[model samples]
Target: MDEVEVVVAHSERTTLRVGDVFLKVDADQSRLDVEVAAMGLAPIPTPEVLWRKPPALAIAAVPGTALGVLGEPSPASPAAWAAAGAAIRELHDAPLPPWTSRSVEEIRVDLDRECEWLITNDVLPADLIRYNREIAEIALRPWTPVFTHGDLQITHVFVDGDKVTGVIDWSEASRGDAMFDLAILTLGHEEHLADVIAGYGDGADRDVIRAWWSLRSLTASRWLTEHGFDPNTPGCEFDVLRTAFEAARG
Candidate 1:
């Protein structure tokens, strides 16, 4: 957006590329931007990318829009959500050899710390927290953790006509309880969220999945806050989490 042409690419990493060259900015808090571009040719799930000059980092020349329409509110029928579930199942099923595994014992090892987080932030709830823990222990009992999309949902899933074209944004991809991804996607505002998950080739527990999502609200809030990102910022689910936090208190 400076003298250089800038495009809003599907990526948020601040990168700059000129011709075959790439540029990256490594500043955390300087006059310039913090999310610098790094040259990467690795497999990514989005249509556009951000780049930088001199091939140092990835940069954006043109502001990019999502390749397909979103928020159209036209459920491609439960059939589409059903398909999306299959695609996600396959994705979750992929072996993440290079990635470390995740399990309840691993995440819960820090339970005392995670629980202290809610209390310290004044977002802790007694009944809700108790129920959340019980549900997690039960739900996570059946499924082994895997590398997940972390934020899979209707908005992040792109469909072309009836086919799922791409699963965008791997910024949050990591080893976690598979239920973590299922929790967010199957809940929220998607009208067909439940129907779709139920249609997965294998029956998945929905209530337990929802519990995983409810537990992460505070976890994400703390993670973002520490990283200097506000969860309540517009376009994010912070306010909705605020509602959940209050409901938990109730």
Candidate 2:
């Protein structure tokens, strides 16, 4: 928390620290299709498992001025979202696993399970359950088990010279539908979400992407709220997720 020149981030326990070595885990499960800059790849950075004991830790690679700069974009302006969208498209194109420990059906079900946690904890709007159910009904059918970032968000991506220089946090990386990745990137930035989606490869379906985005947004929001995280905190991902939920719904 003092003055330091370098910092490290842990995937399992986030809260970056100022130090030479960074730590992260593979979670309690498996992650695939993950890469790190050390592997000679750019535009996508995955955490390198440096220590896999007790609480897993990994070495992280990042670019200058990412997350620290850019802040949040005004969806009213297409330029920011446009570029971010393109970057995400490139990220989606990055390699990922074709399957995870769970199937697409099971993963889709997690959205409901996450929301239910919110309801059981009395942290979600009661109507959220039905709203999400409708979303699932429409979104669940088109899922294709393919490579996914598992958790994709603008924060995880880094840009340099108009190119995505790096992408971070791979514990969530796994095999799933591309829409899941799309959902993570465009959930709240819906105003510009279209621009981002438009920039994506022609292979993806918009309707499916929107549904999953909406579902994941709600699931992530409830998670933060339940954990007592400040929803309005600046740079707080929970608020971002909630915003994505609204955007996807709209």
Candidate 3:
């Protein structure tokens, strides 16, 4: 008998693994709808959807380990990172998804709100918040939207022997800035940015990508805390923010 393993659990959702099948349970059906639809439309590899029964979607596990995890050193080689980047380029080059993504204004507003919360709650020093907020501004500028894996965390990408095997967790998939996907994938793994950009071909702005790193970390810290996650873990979001601060000063 295959014992169930809890992959992730939070107020919003829970994912369980039973042998080769992964079960995702979310009260919000819309996210599941997006995940299923995005996988169908995506040109790159995605997990096979075995079946779905309202509030629970089952998928067959794809081969290969995750590219990496947050707050940890990646076991994957530079070649694997480059392969993930190439796959991202393919996704961005595909036709846009039917759904609309949040506008720059919306993202800015969210950033402002999250920044204030950080200051008001004393989550981070006001100076740190202000500095990162300034850095975050660069990403607010306009850009051509692409078919993006909206939450392309390294853990969502799988690789085997320097080749990208699959990318999972497509609920956040939508039309968005391509750089945001690249930034998210290499958030804490900045050392691999060059390899990813090399595989992505061209048109990458390093400053903008770094700015997105600050913006994403600042905005996500509060939510991560509420969800019982520790963004302050070494090599995680807080570290990313601190690194940005240091770079600005030096």
For residues 103-142, write the lDDT of model 1, one tens digit per residue. 5676665554665766666664554555555544554454
Candidate 2 C-alpha lDDT tens digits along 1-250: 5454333223334434345345443444333224332233324444444544544444545553342221366322344445556655665566654435466577567876876776787764656555655665567674545555566666665555445555666656555666767766765555556766666747767767767755665556655555555444554444444544465579
lDDT of prediction 3: 0.94
lDDT score at residue 172, model 3, on the 0-100 scale: 95
lDDT of 1: 0.51
- The alpha-carbon lDDT assigned to residue 118 of candidate 2 equals 66
For residues 159-227, could you state the per-residue lDDT of candidate 3 as single tens digits? Answer: 989988889999999999999999999999999999999889888889999999999999999999999
Residue 93 deviation, candidate 3, in Å? Answer: 0.3
Ten contiguous residues minimizing lDDT sum, candidate 1: 33-42
- Ranking according to lDDT, highest score first: 3, 2, 1
Off by over 4 Å in 1: 1-77, 124-127, 145-147, 171-176, 226-250
> In TM-score terms, which candidate is top?
3
Each candidate structure's TM-score, on Cα atoms with residue i matched to residue i, is 0.60, 0.68, 0.99
Deviation of model 3 at 216, angstroms: 0.5
Better of 1 and 2 by lDDT: 2
